[model samples]
Target: MTDTFVALSDPTRRLLLDRLSEQGGLTLSELSEDLPMTRQAVAKHLAVLESAELVASERDGRCKRHYLNPMPLAKMAKRWLVRFEDVPLGSLSGFHAAPAIRPAHHP
Candidate 1:
């Protein structure tokens, strides 16, 4: 969905997603330490990602660790993106192979 794409378009957010994907999960502090932004800013970004359902977090003892929630994206892609791939074979190339006797409206 547009929300997921918009959330992922930011370099900082993408990096956060990558970190969560690679490491499974990370506390806000862990993610903020290596980045240039403040902890608050990271939380703000995470908030957007959370609303988009692109990320999820859980409180672990005293720390809230963020994790990648890819199911929404997987479902969205299956509904929105895969349809393009399933289009009838020649649909895209139809214009290029127009018949020699063109239809009145086509010419």
Candidate 2:
């Protein structure tokens, strides 16, 4: 979805998602520990990701644990990338029906 793409466009958000993917179910504090931004900034980015449905959170006693929701990403990839998957790489390279060539000898 467009929202997902937009959310994924930000490097901070992308890093957050990567962190979630590497270790799912992390709290805001946990996610903010190693980041250059403040916890509030991280939370704002997480909010964007949440709005895009790329991340989900559940209350864990005193805090909420955010986890990566990969369904939307998977759907996007399948919709946009799968079509090109069937096309051969050679065709994309404009080498259709071309034979490999060796370098000519120089005088």
> Relative to the unseen true structure, what is the C-alpha lDDT of residue 96 in candidate 1, on a scale of 0 to 100?
65
Which of the numbered candidates is closest to the native, going by highest TM-score? 2
Q: In candidate 2, what are the lDDT values of residues 8-89, reduced to their tens digit?
A: 9999999999999999999999999988989999999999999999999999899999999999999999999998988977
What's the TM-score of every candidate structure?
Answer: 0.72, 0.82
Q: After superposition, how far is residue 103 of candidate 1 from its true place, in Å?
A: 36
Which regions of candidate 2 are displaced past 4 Å? 89-107
Candidate 1: minimum summed lDDT over ten consecutive residues — where? Answer: 90-99
